[model samples]
Target chain A: MDEPIQNKKVDTPQDNSDVITMRHIAKSFGDNAILKDINMDLHKGENLVILGKSGTGKSVTIKLIVNLLEYDKGELKVFGDEVKDLSEQELKKLRTRVGFLFQSAALYDSMTVRENLEFPLKRILKIKDEKELEDRIKEVLDSVGLPDAIDKMPSELSGGMRKRIGLARTIILKPEIMLYDEPTTGLDPITSKEISELIMSMQEKFKISSIIITHDIACAKITANRMMVMDKGEFVAEGTFEELENSSDDFIKSFFKL
Target chain B: MANAPAASYKGILEEAGNQVLFMFRFFRNIFRFDFEWEEFIRQCYMIGYKSFPLVGITGFIIGFVITLQSEPTMKAFGAESFIPKMVAISLIREICPVVIALICAGKISSGIGAELGSMQVSEQIDAMEVSGANPVQYLVVTRILACIIMIPLLTLMADALGFAGSYLGVNLSNHVSPQLFFSKAFSSVEFGDLLPAFFKTIFFGFAIGFIGCYKGYNSNRGTESVGIAANSAVVNASLWIIVIDGIAVQLTNALGY
Candidate 1:
């Protein structure tokens, strides 16, 4: 089988500018291999969408970038530092630079929207001034277009509103990299499109690199600078949305079929 | 067939080992210098303050019923004056702490277990970790420490209410004033009886918090695990309370307390 087009980029000269680099990465839980010798890169200031079926290790790959899950073999580097070699403090510092939006949004349900947003700002950034805390929270909530939701508990918010709040909470610290695990999974198409637009806008506003894992082709078309299609724990095809759409491979064409 | 029992034994040992490691991590996080005082105070309010009414009621019932039932037996033995002493020693040294701890195992342990389990199921704990916040420090240590501080205080309240209920019981049949009843209750009670029982309730508190936090924190990745964690926390904490009670009794006897 021919290599995916994205594998070609993995061979390019190592650049300090690339926010994340994974080479020959493999991971397994017991005998079940979840990722097998996959190579990938996230260049600075680009949205790299990974499209895969459920359980194809899409979530696991993004999890590895932040050291949420360890790779069993090969190398993963974030900001040129090998992920597995980082000390606990260094791992934590790396995590602060990267933001992850989980599939379920994963907001602290016990906390109101304002407290949820305040969590990272207080714990990681250690912002002590009440005035500063209030301002930052208001700013982030306003940017997400849910300024009225500051006092509402997570259970009180609609699904789309919760996702937006989750995004706001992650971006509050102004991270350099964002790993979105299905940012628009369960929402209606209109909300999904809006979230995808928000992802693009956030990229433009923050100038941060992103890796969006999704099966939503419409989302891939709207947000991906480049896209990789995963199959059976490996990258089977990779190109721009238009390039992959025009590819001769039937499996690649299946993703683009309306 | 022989392998089955061996496997079961190995599984239990492995679980015990994991619990020890979890406890060690809890201790390590306690000394990590950035104790979450705000969250600790909040947990104390939730775990300690909110649980007072139930404990108070149970204590009152235990004291009243024990006094009432023991009356006939005491009158038969021609030792009716010993009723207050008997209720006092029994409630303070044995019944109040054990019963109150068991009640907490059902209420606090199960509550913490389910709450944390649901948090785990929803991936909030993961979100905290990825955000570089210590979830153990924020969630586990605060809850356990709150249980430790609050359970003893709750037991103390139970002890007082138990005595009050006993006074009411004593008044129902006879005409002892509050002063006479309390003085009679304390006359036979010594520091030896108080110290060991009071000391054992502390262990009971620790066991309840530790088991609850451990079960909830390590719950598997499913909604079903939430219920399982809660059930397991209550059962294990209840069992630990009994085991600790037995050990305390043996130690007290050996030391001539």
Candidate 2:
């Protein structure tokens, strides 16, 4: 218990090309196929959304990118580094640059919002200066439009507010790539729209590439620069919001329908 | 119906393997880069401090009832005067520590399991992993280390209460001053009797924390798994407590306890 921790210092340089690339990505659970031979790419400063029905592996795709879920077969690269090939130290460095927002917001329920936001800061960035840490917390909270909710608990917030706080926690470290799983699921239409707009605002403000997996067309339409509609384990369509909306494919039309 | 046992057998084997791996990972993480001091203290408060009342009550009842029930038999043999000595030896050497551990397996282990399971199910564990903060160090190491520190402390407290309860039980039928009773109690108890038992509680602590963390941290992603993790944590931790007690007793005996 008295042993001091040996800090393993790590740093990965920023790149200008594709932030994430996947080819023939596949994952399965038992005998069921979740993602099958999927290929995708997210270039720098792009917002890519994968729209799919429930149980269609939308969340699985994003989880795979972060190495939270291992792909049965595929090559997944984030920031041009093969995800499967990265060492533990490299993976940790990669994760610090690519923030993931869980579907449930996944706030540390025990910690107040301030502590929750401070978690990644203290543990990951190892930020020691109190003034800089507080300033970062304030800035992220303000950007998410919940500056007053800093001292509040996640349990005290509504669904939308929790999502905003979740995003704030994710972005406080200023990651170059963000992965959002169902950013606006289970919210009212108005709140959903607000979250979609917030995602776009974060993209524009931080200039971070993001992969948002959602079922809500409103979310995709509002936030996605390009969208991929998934069916079964494969993407059935890929285009801009308007292109996918105007496409005659019945599968794509089903998602676009009100 | 035929496949049920086979499936269950496979499930048990899988769980055992996972638990072993979890234990290894826990040890590996503990000696790694950083320790979560804040979280560890918080877990100490949650696991150790919060568990006192229940473990205390359980230990007391155990000591009192064991003394009370064995009275007739001891008196039949005209050995009534040995009650305090007998109770003290049994309580300090085995009964109090084991019973308190089982009680903790129920209280502390289950709570750890449910908490970690819910965290796993809700993706908080994954979120922590992706955030570049070690969840194993933060969550598992903290909880386990808290138990390692706390279970002995709890066992020591429970042993004291058990002696007190036995004193109260002893006085119910016959008048004996606390001084006389403790003097008789301490007459038969040596450092040998206390040391092995006290030592075993550390393993009891490890068993409870490790099993609970294993069940919960490896739990599948479902709400049902939370309940499953908590329930399995208690069952497995209690089992491990007995197993560890057996091993500790054998080792102590080899050392001439």
Candidate 3:
């Protein structure tokens, strides 16, 4: 019963406080184009939720921001610096400023949770003192609500616990920006809600910007400050959650009715 | 369907090119500072020390079986006294190094392939990379260097064990003492024989480590690829070991080693 509004151009608010900006980004793997001329920006201290079906390149967008995957065309600038032009050392320094939480949490299986947290601290921060490492680890563990998990292996934890630990590892470096690739995927509803809440708390506590990619409506409702729904390698709609929820376009409204 | 064979050939050529490039990266990373000495030492223990029991057992059995099998032929020619000399020379110049390397190809290469493949499938390598940690320097370099150092030492141990097995085989049929058997065994093994064999094992180690790490590090994103990586690592490493052995033998002969 919604009126046709497909022709309406939802204006994205522009600001100088943007931490990540992708101008006309296009990426392809062979013949299959993942992102075709996509333009977006992640503003400072905002949770930007990208909702899309599987393989619509929502995850790919965040990956491009972190330079996990390179875009074939267009400008990708992080913190006002061009990403593709950075040298290896510069790129590494950039990566340290951005934290990425993969879908599987990607916790090193061979390492204990404490070692997992210690990895970035030791490697990137170069913190050599045992006491400092211990204090930082304790503080991060408390933040993630997993203090007892320090000595435990990743395999011993549940999916939610792994995601928490993964989040802990990401923020342990105190990154300015966070990229969460399907943070609440493959979890029970209760656990997913908890994770979404945790994401909000993390933004509040660390004062970090985030780009969260997910298909979970509940998660999007709880976490997204701004939402972008993508279809066929391009974002079809962009607005705040309430604006999108009541959008006149059927395609945009379809997301909320689920 | 018409281009199937050509496509397959192209794929193989592409694989070869990738492997060469991977080797180049390995050499380049070797000079980088912040070398992972702890991981390298750990890899040495895993790839080298843990392989002792299998290598030792295989070396012993090979020596024992060869002596038993060759005894009747030697007796027919009245060359029974030359048995120790023949076993010593053959085992040192060819048997011990090649056999032990093949064994390690099965053990070490396949292990690395599976481990790394799983790591890839699970995105652990990507995680490490995004964390600003150099995975190649940490994982690949340490493993390859461990293989290079440990394989030679393992071959030396296997040679000693092989000689002991030959001694036992000799005692099973004759009254020869350990002293006389060892004396005859070592008398013909010159530095010329040992050096080429030792050097060839180093190449074998490189092949095993290189192929395994390459297969694993570059595995496709699927659970099935883990098995493929492990299988291909073993098969390719074993093949490269034989090829390198053949080439080394020709080079040694040309140089009169």
Please name the candidate that would achieve the greatest DockQ relative to the true structure.
3
TM-score of chain A of 1: 0.95
Candidate 1 stretches with Cα past 4 Å from truth are: A1-13
RMSD of 3: 5.5
A1-258 per-residue lDDT for model 3 (tens digits): 211212212245445688888878999999999999798988899999999889998888888887889999988888777789878987898899899999999999989999999888888888989999999999999999999999999999999999999999999999989999999999999999999999999999999999999989999999999999999889888999999898999877777785
Worst 10 residues of 1 chain B by lDDT: B26-35
Tens-place lDDT digits, model 2, residues B55-125: 88988888889889989999999998899999988988888889889999999999999999999998899
Predicted candidate 3 versus true structure: per-residue lDDT over B212-236, tens digit per residue: 9999999999999999999999999
Candidate 1, residue B113: CA error in Å? 0.6
Misplaced by over 4 Å in model 2 are: A1-16, B1-10
Looking at model 1, the pairs that clash are none
lDDT of each: 0.92, 0.89, 0.92
Q: Which sections of candidate 3 miss by over 4 Å?
A: A1-14
| lDDT by residue (tens digit), candidate 1, B155-186 | 98999999999998988989999988899999
Span of 10 residues, lowest total lDDT, candidate 2 chain B: B15-24
Per-residue lDDT of candidate 1, residues A141-229 (tens digit): 88889999999999999899999999999999899999999999999999999999999999999998999999999999999999999
Interface RMSD of each: 0.7, 0.5, 0.7
Ranking by DockQ: 3, 2, 1
